[model samples]
Target: MTEAATRRVPGAPCWVSLIVHGLSATQDFYSQLFGWEFRPGPEQLGPYVRALLHGKEVAGIGQLPPDRHLPIAWTTYFATKDADVTAEAIRSCGGTVAVGPIVAGSAGRMALASDPGGAVFGVWQAAEHLGTALAGTPGTPVWNELVTRETASVAKFYQAVFGFETEAVVSADFDYQTLHLRGRPVAALHGVGHGLPRDRGPHWMTYFQVADTDEAAARVTGLGGRVLHAPRDTPSGRLATVADPEGAVFTVVRPPED
Candidate 1:
């Protein structure tokens, strides 16, 4: 595993978080699934804890505000130099900023926003905390992708808001575009068309690295979660889609061997 001590490049996915109704149960589910240890942090946001792998920060889980009727799903946060500017850019580009560009104590400044397709995400300006602090290891976040109804207009929205360069897959059957930062692929936008789940609107999907995809899927069920998709081999790796006990969906992937 590698230590991520510095802020990620602007527009790159810097962190992923989930807000759920059952904080203790959610933590227990992830701890058994990913071998993550918890540490209290960023207390400004109600009851929250950061997941750590071998002392390096990996992700965060927090309890949802009781009165807010929000979905229990993971949110992907993109690194930005200035949260206020990014929030404005989102508004000007036909997106909405649902939350503030408020400071999370000394951790960072953040805002929640949704794309033109209604895919929610976050813009983070790092301060003392540099988002996810480890990578290249099992149990840490490896990839983030926006799965939406269509890619063309929403892709343009992201490009305008974050200055990302996009490279689209040329295949006729695959409607996908990879978002690039400094010529390196940072994230992806997948146009699922009619395949988009009716109950779950367009959303950012976070992929956590695992050693074995099949075993991980089995473990998810054993831990009171449900496997939405069985393990399957993809061009990228073997992966499975799963939802926690409270139905926060995410993917677990075992990357193709190098």
Candidate 2:
């Protein structure tokens, strides 16, 4: 397990959350898959629960209103020193702040925004909740990345909004860039061009760490989730892309053993 964060870092991926229609079923699927336990969270927005691993907060799952038609997907939230400032920066940088920099009780101030490419994300000014409490272990988020049609304009947007320094992959065939803050890589951007999913559009993808990628992929299938990509070895580790039964897509990875 990763060390608990004592403070939030501006522009870093601080949390990930999912909104689904069937909260109980979704919780059960994740509980069996990742050994998570759920606890009630602030209900200022809706029925929500914080997922915990060994009593440490790992992620969040919330229920959508019956009349709401928003897509069921995992949203990545970036930490900010000030949500209002971040929201204004997003707007001035050609991104759209679709939701408020409003307070969720005393948990935090939050706003939902989309980059120029229409990839949705959240900016959070934390208060009582300090975002994800544990990571880098099974059932916890390991990475957050934006898979979009192109990286240039969106990368500029992020940099202008969050002051991220970027490092591009020196490759002829690949279009990838890593966004960094304070000399540490925080998140990544990939240009998939026309290969972007028609149904999903441009969106952030969350990666959850697992002990075994192949086994996790199989478990996803057994739990009624779909494996969008079969487990494959990469320089980073073995990984698979998958979607929950509700169609929220994420990746599962097992890093190379030390």
Candidate 3:
């Protein structure tokens, strides 16, 4: 079992949240899929719900502002010791700071930014809220990665902002790099080159682990989500890409049995 305390290493993906419409339906779908329970956040947070697994926070669900017509997405947040400094680093490094450095009640301060390639993500400076309490287990996020066409530029931008070191994974068909913080792998980047469908843009993808990929993919469809890619075995695991009823895309993986 993989476990980490509430505190996270800076530059690690310490929090994830879905921005979508219909909070009730979103809660229901995830509860059925992962057996997660919901807890209400501070009222000031505005329609935010915390997802708990066995009484520990695993993820969050928040409603998009009614006036904004943004597509539903899962935003992955990297841990930061100083939100203000991180926001400035992002802006100076060619990324756009879209929001925050604002207080999230007593939890911490947060800000959202879009990388030069247009992949949007968040940074969290923890106070009382230490972000995710459990991970590396079923139903909790296991990995987060950036998929874009501008590999070199994106690498430089992240290294400048977060001091991430890129280790290229030698592959013939794909250009992939692992983003490491001090020596541990925290996230990854994949260069799609000319392969991205015109309808899709660069974005951060969040991954959740399961015990059985085939079974989970079936359950997703039964529960009103769509499995975009059928389960396929990889060197690391058996995985599939899927979308929730609200059109947010993520991956589900069942690690190879020991």
Candidate 4:
């Protein structure tokens, strides 16, 4: 495991959380799939809980609020120096602040927003919690990708807000860009110009590292989750897209052995 002993750099993806209707079911499925351990969160936070890998925080699970209708999905939050400042910047960049620049107990300050392309994400200014404590290992988050049709606009919007260096990959059929922080890739933008299912819309997909993509994908189905895409080898690793039983999509990738 690669222990992240310090806070993630600003503008990098810091954390991810799934909003689900069945918290216990979600916990059980993930624990069986990824060997995660759960820690109960504050009562005021509803059924929110943190998922840990080998004693280090990796992700979270929260019960969907009954008051407002929301889809069961994973939200990826980027690290920011200040949530209030980032919220203002999001507005200035033509995005909408859906939730708040509010305190999440003593954990951190957070705000939910949708990019101009309507891809929802969050920003976290860590305090007592410094986001995920490990990466580049099995059961830890390794990458995040935003899929959208508005490639140019979305790229411009993020560059304006985060000062991200957008590097467009020259390709014939794929319109892709990598968001770099100080020359290091932090996240990716995949433009679904065509060939994707018509029902697909803009969203952020979180990728968790696994030891074996095929085995993890098999466990997903065994645990009642659906595999949206079968495992395929890529330059980065072997990856497959899968959704929890409630339909929150995420990716599992087995990175090439170092």
Candidate 5:
């Protein structure tokens, strides 16, 4: 098996960061929900801003150049050893490379690409920075999911690119499959079915841990963000779908940790 196939995150569910169109507004929306703290990064780093939750570094947020019309949303990044090879794997698997195997100084390298199902994800080659030094508390990434109406096609798409295996996980109440890399659970994939809204697209949504679901949902609307779905309970936790001011849909989950 390929090294990439065998490679597993020693601790899965790593930190997730995103590049948004409107940095100021996105910052305000998230800070209120998670009580995030932010400050300017190195002066040479341009406009990149680092965010901390509960006094621990959680994610990075930066503004897209003025010429780009990208929507504001969270992008998921997986830890990889070689970002360039991963980009090639993305192409080889019927996925597209959307960005670069760009270097992040002594912090390792990264690249952005989309899966065959149109879900965008990132690959991080960690050096000094291993990603989300802190996670799963108030203000860090709690869970990541890929939601699609055609789960089989999406599964094949990810399996072809990431070299991970997936099995159908069906139960009396829930229908989902867990994605495994070398038999280790990396993430989950499930069908959204035709009951989903029309504007919804096959995509990966990152969830942030929070204290209260209703308060978080209300704060999203209070800050110019939209609540795509109201608070709902799953076997895992209480979750609510939301969109940043620029229209990227993500979820906020407050699950009891083990």
Candidate 6:
């Protein structure tokens, strides 16, 4: 099983989505790398669509709408017991509250917030279900990692909101400080004392696992997705950056053999 699969809260990371600028091409590019199939569903909010990977409901991807002016990015949803409380903790912990504390039908509730370093994530309150009906296999969401500065402060922020415990990132000795909730690793923390990509703001990036990073990267190229960064090895294993034909950027991670 994937390290991410071992991190479930009986239904954690239940859902996630990649916010993009263009819907048509974004769908085509990701279908190649992750083998995801997105189809229009009952319109709930905006152009929301159901995302499936390997024939299982995994997540969602849709245009953020032009009025929002938000860049294309991936957002993850962590199953929470209470989104209202989670939203409050986010503000108290020096994070930004972007949206929610709103109930999403019977599926559950959600609150959108950002960490101290400006990486945005969501808190999900599971009702009849918890999170992703599927995860942690090849071409599925195996991890949600954050790359930013202020590892300690970021850890503190998440701890306050999600009740996660964190050790010193420096001690993890890995590229990022891993965080745990309910005795299971939920996400990672990356410090950025170094310079940014030509100087951009700090943000969160999601990594979906695949069987072969090189082959997936090649598929991304073939599907007209932009390769932002070539495959590289980290303490976590091989990873690469890719942007959909529509310019939505996300990563692909291939963990070391178990």
Which lDDT tens digits does candidate 6 get at residues 58-145?
7777667677877666788877667777778788889888888876666667778887777777777877545566666876777776
**What's the distance in Å from true for residue 51, model 6?**
1.3
Please report, as a residue range, the 10-residue window in candidate 6 with the lowest summed lDDT: 2-11
**Per-model CA lDDT versus the true structure:** 0.93, 0.93, 0.89, 0.89, 0.73, 0.71
Model 4 lDDT on a 0 to 1 scale: 0.89
lDDT of 1 by residue, 1-258 (tens): 787648789898999999999899999999999999999988898999999999999999999888877889999999999999999999999999999999999999999999888889998999998899999889999999999988988899999999899999998889999999899998999999999999998999999999999999999999999999899999989999999999989999999999
lDDT agreement of model 5 with the native? 0.73
The sequence of per-residue lDDT tens digits that candidate 2 reaches over residues 183-227 is 999899999999999998999999999999999999999999999
RMSD of each: 0.8, 0.8, 1.2, 1.3, 4.8, 3.0
Q: How accurate is candidate 2 locally (lDDT)?
A: 0.93
Top candidate by lDDT:
1
| lDDT of each residue in 90-137, candidate 3, tens digit only | 999899999988898988889989999889999999999898888768
TM-score of each: 0.98, 0.98, 0.96, 0.96, 0.86, 0.87
User: In candidate 5, what residue range of length 10 has the lowest lDDT sum?
Assistant: 1-10
Pairs clashing within candidate 1: none
List candidate 3 segments past 4 Å from native: none
Q: Which scores higher on lDDT, 1 or 2?
A: 1
lDDT of 1 at 166: 98
Model 5 lDDT tens row, 170-245:
6754557888876777788867777555665666788877788878888888888889899999888899998877
Q: 149-238 in candidate 4: lDDT tens per residue?
A: 847889999898888999998988779999999899999999986655465578898999999999999999999999999999998799
Candidate 1 residue spans exceeding 4 A from truth: none
- Model 6 has an lDDT value of 0.71
Off by over 4 Å in 6: 1-12, 169-175
| Residue 111 lDDT (model 3) | 92
Considering summed lDDT, which 10 consecutive residues are worst modelled in model 1?
1-10
